[model samples]
Every structure is written in C-alpha cells, then in structure tokens.
Target: MEFYLKENGVRTQLEYGELDISGNEDYGYRPFQLMIASIAGCSASVFRKILTKKKIEIEDLHITAEAERDAEHANKITKISLHFIVKGENLDKGKLEKSLELAKKNCTMVQSVKGSIEVVETLELINLSN
Candidate 1:
C-alpha cells in the first residue's frame, strides 16, 4: 500500500490492492466516516479499559454513531453523536459518564476535531446476558 499527501494539505490519497482510494470515496465510506470511526473506536477502547479497571463485568458492548453533513459546497461534517450501549453487571451510571468524559479528554482524535465538529454522546446500560 502506498499513501501520498500533498504538503500542508488535509487530504491524503491512498492506493492499495488494485484500488484507488482517496480521502473520500464514491461508493465506500468517506473521509468523515473514517474520522468518526476513529473517535468512536478511541472512546470505546477507553470505556472498556475503565470498566475492566473498575472490575465491572461486561458481557457485550456496542456503539452506534451518526453524523450530520453540511449540505452547502465544501460539504463537511457538522455534528456527530454516538450511543454507547453496554451489557454488564453492577454498572454505575456516574462512573460510565466519568469514563466517557475522560475518554473524550484523552482521545487524540476527539481532541483533533475540537471546534471543527460538535460531538454528543449517550450512555445506555443493558440487561446482563444469559
């Protein structure tokens, strides 16, 4: 795989496996998708780590994310939201919120989008697995 980026540019071009993929694609996930994924992935990892550290037993975890794109020219993402649903035992809502806060604070990707994007998050607890 070869990746190229123009000097002082935000966009990058990537080539891999007989495919030409740019920062944004026509059919596959766009650049914004990758950005959101990084945020969600970072937060999810922090959440899991915090839960494990607190000795909270987790049976499953999932995150659903959505973003609103600007309709005008130079289309870009304006807002993003993520719903974090965790199935675990003896979960504490306060702790979960705190963990999320710390996740956003520590996540380089989340901080990278600061002021450029708006992010909202929700936490949900699910019944323990059978």
Candidate 2:
C-alpha cells in the first residue's frame, strides 16, 4: 500500500517484494501482472496447506496462469485459467480436486475477484509412488 518515488520511478514493497510501477512493462511490474501473481501465490499456498493437511506428501508443485483480456472493455481481464501440476506420492485425484476447490474458496485474491472474473482450475497430479 505504501509507495516510494525513487529516482527510477514509483515502487511498492511488502510481503512479496519490491515492485516498480513505472508504466514501463519492460522495466517495471505492471499492475495487472501483480494481480495475477497474487492470485497464483495465494492459491498455491492454500492448495499446499490443504493437501499436506490431508497427509499427502508433495514432491513438487507448479502453477501456470493464463488470462484473457477484453479489448473492447478497456483491456480488463475477462477470464483466468490456472493449471496446476502436482508431483507427489500416492496422490488421489479426488482428494486433489477437493483440495483445489478449497484453495480457490479460501484464497483471498481469488475470493476478491471471484464475482468479476471467470476462474478455471485444472489439476494434473503426477503420482511418482508406483
């Protein structure tokens, strides 16, 4: 919430890190990018907590986010799709799906924009324990 107008440009740093909002996409972090990052980061944490609490041992977890913007409506994000790749041992598809659902509900960023943006989540569980 707090910003510092440094020599380069305006920047904000908090729980995540320092972000430059100089309006130069190449040199600074765009507001839209930060929004998506918040969603992805919150979802990842919540999802991990849900799965771990269920006794699932995770080897790796990766989240990919893609968004569609409405060009006719001031380039606002219309839809966002999240793809999760979870590598783990004895992973149950049903449990993973349920965990993802819980994560989407509990994630603050996702909850904040749930009514405005269409969010889709897909979980790809890779079971290494065979």
Candidate 3:
C-alpha cells in the first residue's frame, strides 16, 4: 500500500476506502489504536470461526481490547488484554474456553506479535436462556 504524506499524517487509498494514519488523534487514527484493533479483530474472527465449526450458535459477540504502553520506550505497546462478551443460548463455558485457546494459537496477528507483545484473552458468557 502506498501512503501519501498529508499535513499532519499520511493517507492511503484502498479498495474499500481511504485510510488516514497519524500520531495525533485529531488528524486520523493513531498507530497504536490500529495495532490493537488488528489484534482484537483477528482474534475475535478466528474465535467465531472455531465456534461455528463446532456447531456453537451465538446471538452476539463483542470484544474489548486494552493496551498497555510503555512511556519510557517510545510509547511502545507492551501488552494487550482482550475481553470477549458472548451472548447465546445453552453456551458451554468449557467449550468456549477451549475455542479461545485454539484461537490464540491460530490467530495470525496474535502469532505475529507473540514474542514482542503479550496478548491475554478473557471471556464473559451471557446465556439467553437465563
């Protein structure tokens, strides 16, 4: 992808649309935010696929990510925590937990940053039957 230098940041045009990246949030998305998003999005997608393959139906799935950055070292991301809120009927907690483990193992983005960034995943299940 080619990025053109803008006033404050850089802009890239893609098939879907244009992407603006900047250090300043006022101009565009921050680099760290995008990194966290990539990790979380990849994990969630892989987890959902694993569940589907196991015939687990879900009403909804949401993921929240928190990143810990070190101020002393160029504000680099040191760790990321991902919390998953899963809403479904008759959801097996054990199976979901296993699926999450498998997702962590298989997610490309998670694997990419394995040695550099610590990734932690947690799950909260909401049973529709309740």
**What lDDT would each prediction earn against the true structure?**
0.76, 0.88, 0.96
lDDT by residue for model 1 over 5-72, one digit each (tens)? 53332443455333333454653445677778988998888777877787777788899999988989
> Between candidates 1 and 3, which one is better according to lDDT?
3
Which is the better candidate, 2 or 3, if ranked by TM-score? 3
Runs in model 3 lying further than 4 Å from the true structure: none
> On a 0 to 1 TM-score scale, where does candidate 2 land against the true structure?
0.90
Q: Which residue runs does candidate 2 get wrong by more than 4 Å?
A: 5-9, 15-17
Cα deviation in Å at residue 122, candidate 3?
A: 0.3
Q: What does candidate 2's lDDT look like per residue over 41-130, in tens digits?
A: 999999998887988788999999999999999899988899999998888889889899999999998999988988899999889987
True-vs-predicted CA distance for residue 44, candidate 2, Å = 0.4
lDDT of 3 by residue, 45-123 (tens): 9998999899999999999899999999999999999999999999999999999999999999999999999999999
Worst 10 residues of 2 by lDDT: 22-31
Model 1 stretches with alpha carbons more than 4 Å out: 1-28
Could you estimate the TM-score for every candidate?
Answer: 0.76, 0.90, 0.97
Candidate 2 global Cα RMSD: 1.8
Write down the worst ten-residue block by lDDT for model 3: 60-69
Pairs in steric clash, model 1: none
